[model samples]
Target: MRTTGGQLFMLVVINAALLAVGAMISGGTYLSPFNLQSMAGQLPEIGFLAIGVMLAMCAGNGGIDLSGIALANLSGVASAIIVGSFLSSTDNETAFSIAFIAVALLTGLIGGTFNGLLISRLNITPILCTLGTQMLFTGIAVVLSDGRAVAVGSPELLSQIGNGLFLGVPISFLIFVSAAGLIAALLKFTPFGLWLMLMGTNPKAATFAGFPKARVLIATYATSGLLAGLAGVIIAARNVNVKWDYGTSYLLIAILIAVMAGVRPEGGYGRVICVVMATIALQLMSSLLNFGGLSNFVRDFAWGALLLTFLAVGRYNLVGLLTPNKSRKLV
Candidate 1:
């Protein structure tokens, strides 16, 4: 397995290479400030979802959150409807925006908590549990919105969060970086982090050691849900509306990001900074595809290929296979 530092270095190299190629191919359009800002603004929603996937993968027991994007869309749709019922964005823009954000976050928390409960309390497989909830969330959102996009009227604060900038950096991107930093800190400095790692590494050992296994699992999924909630807010801000089926391909892309970051599928390991770097690299690649005038279908095909490549590398220890073993002597 590659160390987190190795993963970071590899991602940095990939990003630099992509930038150079994009500049050459696009005659500098790809390197322009406008394009860079556009990529930065667009990546946060997927970045948030990728981080959530990372958390779920780190919890072990075939853990994975398939419901992240679904829950995110549901968060936006539910918050818009709930907030719109009692407040008008036209008459109370600021308050309505604040309430919408608050409700979205709260809904995400509740939805995640429900998932955690099912998995931890009932001992349901994480994959199956989240898959079920994914459909459940999507169905609820569709029913509530009646298959229509719920418009979140342009409120000052919300619009700024989605499209505004601070110190020449996008506010949405800044929020994502801040959240990643906090998650990194939590993982590095807290007992919860230790418990999660240990639990994933050796569930029986962790249980015998008296760690609160169920609690850690619940917390892990809950944090993932919170991140999904935040992503929902960003989505609504960027599109100025929420729908039941927004970002249909995001779940797969998010999973690809997590896997590329070297998060272990069977659990026990993940790194936030690595995930962030991987997200940037993938975003650069996606932008490069756009510069090349490739169709969306081609972009999807490339992403799927990259995902399968990484999965093969991890599954077969392809890196280890290629590296000469110092301990082995040529006979």
Candidate 2:
């Protein structure tokens, strides 16, 4: 249930080495602790996507939302429109923020609920269900944006929250941490959480075990959508605009992070924290690559190599990396 120390140490060392390499490649600017903080900022949003997809995956060996990126984009558009529809230009930031959260949460729930029905009740395959939803969500986003961008204006506080630093940590990083903390708590402490893992590793066994399989399926998806929507809001808050294609690239990147984080694509074996760490590592790598003068192709190549290495390491090596004090024995 908890990560061990040696694995933790290995992860630290690996990330430290990567950080050093990234900083060295960037020369001076990327070496700063502040730069590290900036890179950390990128992890959370991507982390959200990874975790959201991971939850659905927990119920089956291969459950995932390939359209998660589309969900993220759709949420962003939804948030922008919500603000546009309800929020005021005057100055009451509190009301606007509340409205934004409510809209974001509800919209995400609806999307997730739909996907859950397709998979859980209708018995559609996860891959097919998500693919269909991905297109549907993306279309919804396009329609919301009128095939253009939804720009945020006069939301000064939003830019502050998105870009501001809280005690040297970016606000976006804080949001992710807060969100992750909550999710971790629920998964660790709730019956629903345990059921998810059970369902994933052996759905038939779980059914035989008499777990409320359908409820679990539906709940996981709904949670995923809610989180994805929140990520959208965060992105919108950061960029000060909701771009039609903002989160489109994140779908594959998220899946990559999930795999590297040691979450078994086969389901029922992963940790929220691992995904967060992998995401941080990935983002730092990305930032360093950008500053280090590597071409996008080279960066992508390195990412692929890293992913393969991570996969080869598998869950046990990664767990050993993240939690060394516990079982040295690989799963």
Candidate 3:
């Protein structure tokens, strides 16, 4: 498990290819400050979901997060409805904001919790369990909205937080950094992180080693759900209205980011930094494409291509990524 620059180089190549194609589709320009800023704003929610999914994707554990999009849409709609119904424009803003955060966080937590329970206790396949939840969340959202979008008030406040800049940095970017830092500390410094990954890589051995497999699996799913909820809230905050399919578009990209972020679908291998960098690269690539006037769909295809390529690399061990390295990657 040695990490090497060559392995990292593969990631770079993937990124460069994505950037080049995105630019081509976008019609030329591939770099822009505004686009970077926009990507910064967009990444947090996507990053959150991607990271959430990554935690549970432990290899040999046969787990994956296919329901994040559905969970996000459901949790977001739930947040808006709960907050909007309870607090009017006339109510105290302080209480309203607190309530908003709580409701949103709780909705996501519950979705995640349910996912964990089903996978751990019921012994359902992660894919099947999450698929069920995904359907449940999406269906609930549609039913709640009656196929209509519910508009929220005081978008200015939400915008201020969602679209805010602090010390010339996007608040959302700062949040992603902070979140990654916290998780990195846990993963690199704490035993729990190691154990959780251990569960993913070799569940039979993990059980032999006395790890609580079910709890670990459940917790990972729960954490993923929580992050998805956070992303849901952020996206909902950005939109003036909450719709049933709010996160439908992000589902595929989230999976792409999770894979590119270095989460081995086999379960036990991946990095948050992988998620962050891959996501950033995509963000940058898409921006470059837009600036160049490339068709959005074409830029999207670039991403699809990137996913296909890396997946091949992963499966075939074609690149040096699967090899041991001289220098170890930082935790």
Candidate 4:
């Protein structure tokens, strides 16, 4: 088994423990089919953002995408204005749906391209670039909507995508799973993935070996932007409106999920499977807390505490300390 498998196992154990305790406290309401399905429906939005965070972390260099939720909001706002102008959701459902999705994705791609150009070509630091872009995206969104939420009206097809189920699984969750699978394959089987990992692991070695750093960075960030766009679509689908300030806490939560998945901050190594498990683990924990009648503020505090604990463990190599290597031959 790979290192990811061990990490995944730990996450699974955490998830199970949370579920068991939740069930005990909630008198099995937590384990009911309805609650499980609700959890599945809730997973995709954050999962998509977390994947984008994972990609940036995998690229190293203090890499992170603070702009993901901002860009996602921008994408949704732009889509609503553009799609709503030409087509009525009630009278031209098909055309409106097609145009809505296209505009959302295109907006996301363009925003992502902007980030890639600044970071890859201009040599801006990833964190700084994304932070600036996050504000820029939010500004654009606020100006476009005049700081108010733009309502999408929950069109039939959009609602189905957001809340519908097929074969006893939420469609949004399936979409999340599909996206995760594609990313896993991209990282495992493709030359770009190899170059990316190598670049993150040892930038000097990759540069010396003639790797195309610009192309890799551009593609990686663009892909991250695409994911953000998809997340925007889902967010709009689930909610009746899109606003600049919506999901204000999402950026931090996404980063938390990536870190919990053990994505290295200095770059080089991350696993999509581990990220998937980490996401599920988090959702379970959040649900468990909710079942326990905890307020959202408490939940946020708990998430922050957990994030700090994990970061400290990683920083101090606590796993190494707890499970000393027996292969040292007594030093």
Candidate 5:
């Protein structure tokens, strides 16, 4: 069985249980369509970051991208500056919108590539490397924006991507689902996927087997950066402003989502589907807290506690506790 199967099941069960509890506490308003839509709409931004974290963790060598939310902020800020400059001419709305998305994606790719080069070539520790880049990205964003939020004037297309609904579903959520599906296919049906897992499982053995370790590492991180960039676009669209400090708790939340999804910190294993499930579950839990009239402080504390708990369990491979005793013996 997949390593994430147990966690995924647990998340589903927990999500249902939380919804039941929330409904009881809120006179059934918690299960209303409006609240559900709000919760679904909020999942994509952090979902993208969680996927990026999963990529880094799957790459091994104590790999992690601490700079994901920072790069996302930078991407949005850069895109907003460029697009806002051209908005005076309404005739170029299409061009400006396209340029906006392109800029965000480019920023993400470039930031990711920089991290990849340093880690893959300079042999820098992934944690320290990303930690430095995180500050650098935030610093650059602050400098560019003068330490203020850049207001985003909504272009119709960008607005649609961010807030439009289709068949009772959010467009942003659809984009996230499509991105997740593509990533899952990449990991399941590609040679690069095999090489990545092998490299993460044992870098030395992969090197002996003639894997292009540097190239793989660069590509892995580059993909992660692109995801962050896309997340920036979605965030700017939804919030109508791009601020360096938006979603200040996102960094920790993304890591928590990835860990809860059962992504191995030691590398070589993660499931995109599991990450998606975990994202929804966490969002539901957060929504539940909101329904209970809990403060943001309480939410943050809860998230911290959950992150620590999952980290300890994963570190010890205690996830097996979620499996059935009979299944364990068979395995």
Candidate 6:
């Protein structure tokens, strides 16, 4: 019986502990402004993907967006190729950057709509459908880029969006926060949010209540894809290029963040704020690992372990195991 507030509180405590430990171990480097900025700059790509995963999970029926990173890569690659055809990133940096972002988002929307059609119209399983599309998206990206990274050529506006800071916070981080806030408001105040939650909680009841299941499902995944597209824009800006294999471990990390945020895989429960906090926590942990000079392999192992641990905790109600049960004597 973990309430959202309780979970959020727990995350706050954990984040504080991680920060303190990292600072102590890194001899203050971990708490330095430069290090904090670096972490902020890197957070949005995975944060957006985690948000997409949260949305899909909230839609229930084993909902997940496994194709998120693939879609993101595809978005970037497709945008690079399409935008490069007409506008040069170096000469038309402003217009080129804007067009690149627009195209990336559009690509993501189309890919997501395709996924929604497969799951809702064709009655495909979410996991399998997404897995298949993941491969499809990756294949398309590879073909588009010819198995090479497509350079975005240092557009000033894109660079500013990806790497610049406003009021001592990374612009990308601010964008992520703003997007998360909007989604939070959507879940709180909209009929679609209510429908999504109800549908996940009890599909039969939702159907009886005249909920539009197929439409909701399609919308849910479409929104997820859009987020993935945004992630693509951020990725291209940060790395200055797009490739089919970028962020190979991001899918696992995104899933890990959602689960750590207490987003139930069975759906019907999630909070954008919680997901945000979870993203920061993971970022802190990653920064701490970097300070410790741990290898990427070790970090991956830790992520896998944490994912499994959280899944088990969710499945088995591990907290209840530690609480003593009181028995009443029969009169």
The digit string of per-residue lDDT tens for model 4 on 69-156 reads 9999999999998899878888877777778888998998888888888998999999999999999999999999999989888777
Tell me each candidate's TM-score.
0.95, 0.89, 0.88, 0.95, 0.95, 0.95
For 1-331, candidate 2 gives per-residue lDDT tens digits of 3343443455567688887787677676776877767776666678888889778776774698887778877877887787777667347676776676667667778888888888889989999999999989889888888999886653656666677788888888888988888888888899998999878888889989999988899999989988887777677777767766885558878888877766777888677776677777788778867776779889767867877877777644655555555755644
Model 6 pairs whose backbones collide: none
What's the CA RMSD of model 3 in angstroms?
A: 3.6
- Rank the models by lDDT, top first: 6, 1, 5, 4, 2, 3
lDDT of 5 by residue, 1-331 (tens): 3445677677788788888888999898888988877888899999999999999999998999999999999999988887678663146667777888999999999999999999999999999999999999999999999999998767778888888899988999999999999999999899888888888889899999999999989998999999999999999889878999988899999999999998888889899999999999899899888877899999999999999998887765565666754234212
Q: What value does the lDDT take at residue 273 in candidate 1?
A: 93
Count clashes in each candidate, considering only residues at least 3 apart in sequence or on different chains: 0, 14, 14, 1, 0, 0
Superposing all C-alpha atoms, what RMSD in Å does each candidate have to the true structure?
A: 2.7, 2.8, 3.6, 2.5, 2.0, 3.4
Deviation from native of the Cα of residue 24 in model 5, angstroms = 2.0
Candidate lDDT (C-alpha), each: 0.91, 0.77, 0.74, 0.86, 0.89, 0.91
Better of 3 and 5 by TM-score: 5
In angstroms, the error of model 2 at 282 is: 0.6
- CA-RMSD of model 6: 3.4
Tens digits of per-residue lDDT, candidate 6, 169-256, equal: 9999999999999999998899999999888877789889999899999998998999999999999999877899999999999999
- What's the distance in Å from true for residue 207, model 1? 0.8
